[model samples]
Structures are given as structure tokens and as C-alpha cells.
Target: MRLSCLQENLSKGLAIVGRAAASRSTLPITSNVLVATDEGRLKLSATNLEIAVSCWIGAKIEEEGATTVPAKLLTEFIGSLPNDKIEMALSAKKILTMKCARFEARMTGVDARDFPPIPRVENGVAVKVDVAEFKKGVARVVFAAATDESRPVLTGIDALFEGSVLTLAAADGFRLAVYKMPLAEAASQKVKAIIPAKTLSEVSRLLSDGDESIGITVDTQKSQILFKLKNVELVSQLLQGAFPQYSQIIPQSHTTRAVVETPAFLMAARTAQIFARDGGGIVRLIMTPGGGKTPGRLSITARSEEIGEDQAELDAAVSGEEAKIAFNGKYLLDVLGVISEGQVALEVTGPSSPGVIRPVGTDNYVHVVMPMFVQW
Candidate 1:
């Protein structure tokens, strides 16, 4: 194999595909990145048994061949080279040789045929989604996925595509996050799949700022999902199991509603977290509505018996009735940090019930947090 490519493109491609290379795996080939010439471009791929990433970069191919090299070594070496042309060649003994500018190196590699084959999915129900909206939805929903491996279903995001809409829902048993966005193209039939949060996060990160749309294919026959970007492709195995019926978890109505500014609420939560760290991570939220010409108030407080207590108040648009709720300080910070709207609405039925949070101007997102059982 012989090929020449720009250092910049090779470096970027390595960085993108190297993410899937397994650091510690039972299969040694999974730690290597497969390099080959496809059509008129160079293809770099890596897999860790769960997900695979493939990136194509332009190159001048003198001969057609393939080999697997250490991902970390190649990425580091290519990244250290200057912005110049890199010439690479492979020998029959599985030796990968490369030259860039004034530097040259030869490394031992493995036969490419031993590397895991990336599942090729062509016949499947495909849906296109706007890149910007898809990234936003992933950012809002993936954080709620369960990190514990005991419940496998909760570790994945519930993806539902029907007609022209796509919904992403994730939960960790304590909190739930749901986001909906219009698809760039309409789907022919309803499709449901549970995609791992880690894979979706990587897909979101791979989407460049210049990308306009992303194509998602649900291949039920293969039990895998594929994401196709402009120059990159990601394939992940679907988790087998039934996701929770999350539609019933979202509250339909609320007795107490409070509208608070996003920045203010986030700031209060951040401050409360500092003190709540010593107090079992509990933060208290008290909403008081005003009558006549008086203004409404929302108090955020946290206390530690060994340390001290702190509280911050913000003017809010409160209605219905007064409410006091205790919540995990970290949970409050997580949901509030994702909200970008000017004001956020909080709906609570009572101290024992879950609190629903929604951005005032957007109906596309909703978050539910269970209240902590603590003394008032």
C-alpha cells in the first residue's frame, strides 16, 4: 500500500476515528485503526465492539492495500508533524512506513483482515434530522440516561421516529428528560429503537458546525443503528429490551406554577450546590405568590449541619399556590444548565410529587425531577 495525504486532514481523521479504539480489550485488533484506500479516498476506521467510527479523507493512492496500526501511535505521530504532505507505504510483513517533511518512521502493524468488520447497513428505514436540532436534543436528553449498568434499558435513550417528528427520551430512575424535533424528511413508518447514550454523544460531537443535516438509519434486522455524516459514519448496536413508557411520566397539569429567569435560577442552583455538598446534596426551593400589586418570590436555600446554611431569592411569576420542595442540588444544576430560554416554568402538584420544568417559550423540551423526601 502506498498513499500520500495532507497532514492536517490525516491528523483530523485520526482524532475522529481514534475515539472508538478500545484502550483495554480482550481482542487486540480492536485497539488498532484500520487504514485502507476506498474509491479515491483513504478510509480510517476504529471499533470497540459496541460502536464503530469510520472517516474518509482525500488522498493520492498509488496502490490499493490495507493494514491496521496502533491508533494512539499513529494519531500522536501524525498530530506532531508539521502542516505538510505525508507519504505512507506498507510492506508484506505488516510494517507501516510513513514520511512527513524531514521526519520518517516505520511501525509494526497487524493484518487488516483480522480487524472487526464495520456493519454495512443499506436497506433500512432512514430518517434525516437537522444537525443543529439533533445536537441540541442530544445535549438535553442524554445526560438523564442511567450510568448504572444494573438496569440496561435505562442506560439507553429511547428514540421514536414517526411521520416528520423525532423524539428522544432518557431517564435515570430519578429524573427524566425529553426533547422533540422536526425531522428534515418524513419517515414512511413508525420506528422505535433504544440507542446507547454514549454512542449518541459521540455522534453529536462528530457533527461539525458546518453540517446541515444527518441521516439516521434504523436497521432492525441487524440490531444496529447507523449515523451518516458528510465524511464520517458511526454504527452502534441497539440494546435489547423494552424502554419504560415515559409518556405517562410527564405531568399533564400542575397546581403550582412559577416562572423564573434561566440565568438567575442557574446561578442560585450553582451557589446552593457549593453548600449542599456537605448537607447530603439537598437544596430547598420555596415558591411564594404575591397578591394585588406585590411581586412573587422564589427562595433557593441549602444547609449543612456541620457547616452553615445559605439562601438566595429571585423574583418570579408565581401563581396557583405557595409550594416548598426539596431536591438534589446536582439535579437542579444539571437541568437548569441546559435551559437557554429567558424564563423557565416549574410545575409542582405538591411537595411529595415530581416537579416539571419547561422553558416558557418552547414546548419541545420537558424535564421531570422527583422531590427529595426531607423535613421542611
Candidate 2:
């Protein structure tokens, strides 16, 4: 393949697809990126079996061909080149020659045919959603996914469609995050798919901050899904088992409730975590009400035998009855950081039952945290 493209465009395309390159794969082709020149454009592709990404850039194509080159080396080299046009050509022996200004380098490459073929989304139902909305939904739930591979189903975020609403949910047994948003084009179709957290994270990064729209195609037969942006496409394999029925765990009612400033609560929890253990950081919350009309006092405490103890208090609007609960400080902070609202409502059933945290004036999203048992 021979193509001449601007340095900026080439660098951007490489960075986009380079994210999928396998870092520790047994196959040599998985570590390399496929570069193909066709129809006056240069296409770059990378795959790690589970996920694949492809991007196209406008180029001046002199010869139509394809080859696989080292993804990281090519990306770093192109990024270091001067702000001039770059010329890339492949010889008969699959040697890639890159030249920009006076700098020139040659690297041996493998045949493009050796690279695994990405799944083709030929006939599948396509759904369109706003990029910003999709990214926001992902941010609210992706962090709650379990990283342990022992239960593969728990490592994926469940995307369910019903009517015009799309709900994304993730739970790691300790904490659960659920976010729901309305789809622009409502299809009466229902789709339930478990998408890997790693794949969703990459898709979230690919989405720009603008108001552009994205197309999602689901292939049920092949057990694959495709996300298409302006000039890039991401294909991911869906996780196979049945996700647990998480709704049964959410409490239908609460006996105690408190409304507090989101930022204040987050700050207190983060500071209290200093005294918590490394693996399972625990924090205790004590809610005290003064009178019928007076606001309540929220106190946070954390203690570790090896470390020290911490305590902080903040005034909050409390109702129902007084309650004390213990939880993982890091989990509380993670849920609080994603909320865009100023106030947050904490609903508690008891010390043993899970606590639900919801942003004020929003019923579409709910964060649930399982209480931690403190021996002291």
C-alpha cells in the first residue's frame, strides 16, 4: 500500500484504532495494525479478539494495497514526525517505508491476510442515540461492574431496551449503579445484552463531547454488537450467560431518609477513607436529628487498628427517623462523583439492608450500596 496523508490526520487515526491493539497476545498479528489504502482513503484497524476498532482517513493513494505493521511503533513514530505530509509505501516483501521531511524509516511487516477479520454487521436492527447521552449513561454505571473474571456475567454492563427508554446497569455485589435515558427514535423492540465493561469504556472514550448522533447495530445470531461514529466503528462480542435479576435486591420503601449536599458528603467520605483499611475501606455514617424543624447532623467516622481514626460532621436535611449505617468509603465517592446534581438523597432501611442513594429530583437513576459490618 502507498499513501500520502497529513501528519495530524495520520496520527489521529492511529491513536483511535491503536487502543484495540493486543498488548500481551500469543499471536503476532494481534499486536500489529492493518493499514490498507483504497478508494483514496487509508483505513487502520486493530483487534484483540474481544474488541475491534477501525478508522478511516482521507489520503492521496498512489497504489492500492494492504499490510500489517506494529501498532505502537507506527503510532509513536508518526506522532514524533514533523508537521508535514507523511509518505507510506509497502514493498513486495511486506516491508513498510515511512518518510516525513528528511527522516525515513523502514520496518518489516506481515501480510494483511494474516490479521483476523472483524465481524461484519450486515443485517441487524440499528438504533440511534445521542452521543452525549450515551456517554453520560455509561459514566453512571460502568464503574460498578465487577473486575473479577470468576463470574464472567458480572463483569459486563447490562443494556436493556424497553419502549423508548434505555437502561444501563452494573453491580459488583457490593454496589450497584443504574441509569436510564430516553431514546430519540423509539423502536418498540426490546433488547437485553450484556456488554463487556472494557468494551463499553473504549466506546465511551471514542464518543466526542459534541451533540453528534451514534448508530448501534445488534446482531443477535452472531452475538456481536457494533457502534458506529462519524469515521470510526467499534465491534464487540457480547457476553453469553444470563444476568442476575437485580431488581429484587432494591428495596421498595425506606424508613429513614436524609438529603445532603453531594459535594459535602463526597468530601467527608473521601477524608474519612484515610483511616480505613486498604482493600475494604470502611466508613460509618451517624445521622442525628435535633428537633422537628431543625436540620440533622451527619457525622462520618473511620478507624483502623494499624492506622488512625477520623471523624467529620456536616449539617443535613433529615426526615423520617434517625439511622446509622456503615459502607465502603470508596464506593460512596464513586457514586457521588458521577451525579451532576447539587443535592443527594440517602434512603436507608436498616444497618443490614442496602442503602439507596438518589440524586434530588430524579427518579431515573438509583445507586445502591450494601452496608459493611463493623465489628466494633
Q: Whose TM-score is greatest here?
A: 1
lDDT of 2 by residue, 48-163 (tens): 99999999999999999999999999999999999999999999998999999999999899999899997888656678888888988999999999999999999999988767
> Which ten-residue region of model 1 has the weakest summed lDDT?
333-342
TM-score: model 2 vs. ground truth: 0.96
Per-candidate TM equals 0.99, 0.96
Q: What TM-score does candidate 1 get on C-alpha atoms? A: 0.99
Candidate 2: list runs displaced more than 4 Å: 278-280
Tens digits of lDDT, candidate 1, 103-210: 999999999999999989887789899999999999999999999999999999999999999999999999999999999998889999999999999999999998
Give Cα distance to truth, residue 333, candidate 1, Å.
Answer: 0.6
Model 1: CA > 4 A from native:
none
Alpha-carbon RMSD to native, per candidate:
0.7, 1.5
